[model samples]
Structures are given as C-alpha cells and as structure tokens.
Target chain A: DAGITQSPRYKITETGRQVTLMCHQTWSHSYMFWYRQDLGHGLRLIYYSAAADITDKGEVPDGYVVSRSKTENFPLTLESATRSQTSVYFCASSATGTNTEAFFGQGTRLTVV
Target chain B: GESVGLHLPTLSVQEGDNSIINCAYSNSASDYFIWYKQESGKGPQFIIDIRSNMDKRQGQRVTVLLNKTVKHLSLQIAATQPGDSAVYFCAPRQAGFQKLVFGTGTRLLVSP
Candidate 1:
C-alpha cells in the first residue's frame, strides 16, 4: 500500500476506443515511466515524465499519451486504441534517473479487440 | 528504444545448479545496466544494477558483470532454486535519462 499501484489489473477494450491506464506512487519520485511488454519484444517505453509537468516520448509513442500533472500520479492514455496496442502495461518510478533502481507496479493486462 | 538483447529466450536448469543469463547492449551512451526479475502476472522487479564504471556487482545470490568493451552484460545466479524460476530482463539506461531500454527476457526454469 505504500509503493506504486496500477488500476484495473486486466482490461478488454474495443478498437478505436479511448482507454486510460492509471499509475500512482507514494514516494513522490521525480521520474515516472510507462512501458508495454509484448512477447519477443521485451518492454518498450511509451512515455515518461521527469517531474510533475514534463513528459517525453520514448520508442513507441504512436497511440499513447501520458501526463503528469501531479508528482504522485502519471496516467497513460490511448487516444485511439488499436488491436496492436494490446500488451501488458507497467508503471515505474524512481527518485532519479541516474543510477537509482526503478520500482514497478503490478502490470495491467490490456487486450484490444 | 535501443536494442538490449539476450542470447537465449529460455533456459532450463536443475535446482541447486548455477544459472547464467547473458545480455548485449549496443548503446555506447548507456551508463547504467540493471537486471530485473518478473514473476508471472507481475511487473519487472529490480534485482541488481551495475554502473558503466564497474565491471561487476554482486547481490545476495546474484552477480552482474558489465563488459563495456564488447558492450555486453551478464547475470549469474548461484544455487538456482525453484523460486528463482521467472523471466529475467536486462535494461540499460543512459546517463541522466529516465528512459530505460529493456532486453527481451530469458525465461529461467529451475527444475527440482
């Protein structure tokens, strides 16, 4: 209850629909990241926020959007969910990006139909 | 993301035997490397990390080796146990950057 948490451990959504995955951390970490895990592809970063108001795109940012209005919360949104967008989503936080090990939350298994 | 890759996707080892997982990274800018273990239905958990300046680092039952010359890294587990059966991933991060590139994990199976 003191670490990071993700909402909707599992989700099933229709294509072209909008979906948002929630992430919250209690440590008030300076960095928050969203990664999607797919078979044979490993974990790909979709978006990351350095602080409360800064966010940037990673490798795969096509259908994903992320915002960090608060230091404790960073939410990822799929503007138009596609079938290929289905994957296990992980939210992680770290005190800094230099050498600090990130703490990950329980992933959200999302399937787009 | 940058490519962080492992040699094998699956490994089967007898319980009590030592296990080694290998990873290769291509980014010369990466300054930190870490190994993570992901149990079924869970996110990747940090196991150990070694900076670019260090050649090796050890944890409780695991050791990580970093070869900046060849841009490779490895994780070795001593006395592998059934509880160690999980997917292991290696991630390399650039200095002062928050985005970490994760390698395709190696599934380690410890058979009793």
Candidate 2:
C-alpha cells in the first residue's frame, strides 16, 4: 500500500510493561505525528516530528516516547504502560507545509490490563 | 483500548436538513482551525479549514466559520445525508506550527 500503516491494529499489554507502536508512511512526508484518543478528550498530540531526527513534545507526552530516525518511520513507545495509557493511538503524516492536511492511518487500539 | 459509547456530544438530524456543529477553544495563540470527520473504525478526514484572519470559508457542501474574538468555530453542513453521519472534530494550531490540537468531537447522526 502507498498510504500510512500501523502495526497490530489491536494490542493488549500488561501494566508496567513496555510496548512500542509502529508507524510507517510511503509518502516520505516531512511531518509525522502521534496522537491518542480517549473519552471526553479528543485526539491529543503526544509527539510530532518535523523531519528526520527532529521530535518535539505536544500537549500530552509524559509517558510516551517517540523516535524518528527515518522520514518514512516514526515509532512511539510506552516506557511503563499504565491503565490510564490505554487508548486508540493514531499516526499521521503530512507534507512540508504548515497548512498541508495530515493523512492518518487506521488507529491502533492499545489496552493495558 | 476499550471505548465507551454515548460519551460524545451528539447531534441528531433528519436527512435533507441542515446541520451545524460548534467547537470552542481557549487558546489565544491558535491561528488556524480545521474541521474533520471520522467514521466508525476510521481515522479523521479533513472537511474544511478557516484561518484566524478569515471569518468564513466554504467548501463543496461544508462551511467553516472562525470567530477570533470569542475563540469559537463552527462547521455547517448543507442538506445533511446519511453518509454525513460521523464524529466531527475541530483542530486548532498555532502560527508557524504544524502541531494540531483537537477538541472534543461531536457525533452527527443523520436519520434517513
């Protein structure tokens, strides 16, 4: 496929364990982002990368870590998963413009037990 | 993760009727706002966007209105259809920034 993709459309992990969610885009977009959707709170940005090797924190990035070593790949890791960390994670990519619309992948539903 | 139903604010409308969804933000630095539609089990798709400098922007069947004074934005759909039923979200971004922050979504249900 030519669009963005997310691994393990669904995942279940134990609390305090470590898990990493993978994101890949074929467009080689310059901007990639990770967001979590929960009840009452819409899609909140966890981390975003402007380009390769450049990442920044968003509104909620306390327990999440992101890395972007390659333009086509951006992975998010949960150092110590907690119950509160359970949510639907979405990965998106956009071209090199500030006004460019982002393209999102089918979310990964992560459940922490 | 497990998601509960009926938690989001919903707007129920009959087919052929006009629908309007509203969103509010408190960030004064937000320079651009966009409306997105998300179907079940799918990611959001952009509908329309309006910048802080503009008051209203119109698309094919959707219109976005931005009110910088009160920090309010709205998305209006003309002639609602069953296919238009989905969760609608408003995202705001600061100037010179690509990071978008979304607001709580409103689920639009169109009855045929």
Q: Which candidate comes out best when scored by TM-score?
A: 1
Model 1 misplaced stretches (Cα beyond 4 Å):
none
Q: TM-score for all predictions?
A: 0.97, 0.92
Taking the tens digit of each residue's C-alpha lDDT, what string does model 2 give over B19-111? 989887877887877788999999999888887889999999898888789778888999999999999988887778887777779999999
Poorest stretch of ten by lDDT in candidate 1 chain B: B94-103
Write one digit per residue (lDDT tens) for candidate 2, span A23-78.
Answer: 99999899999999998888988999999999999878999999999999999999
> Cα deviation of A106 in candidate 1 (Å)?
0.4
The fraction of reference A/B contacts recovered in model 2 reads 0.74
Instruction: State each model's CA lDDT, in order.
Output: 0.93, 0.88
Cand 1, B chain, TM: 0.97
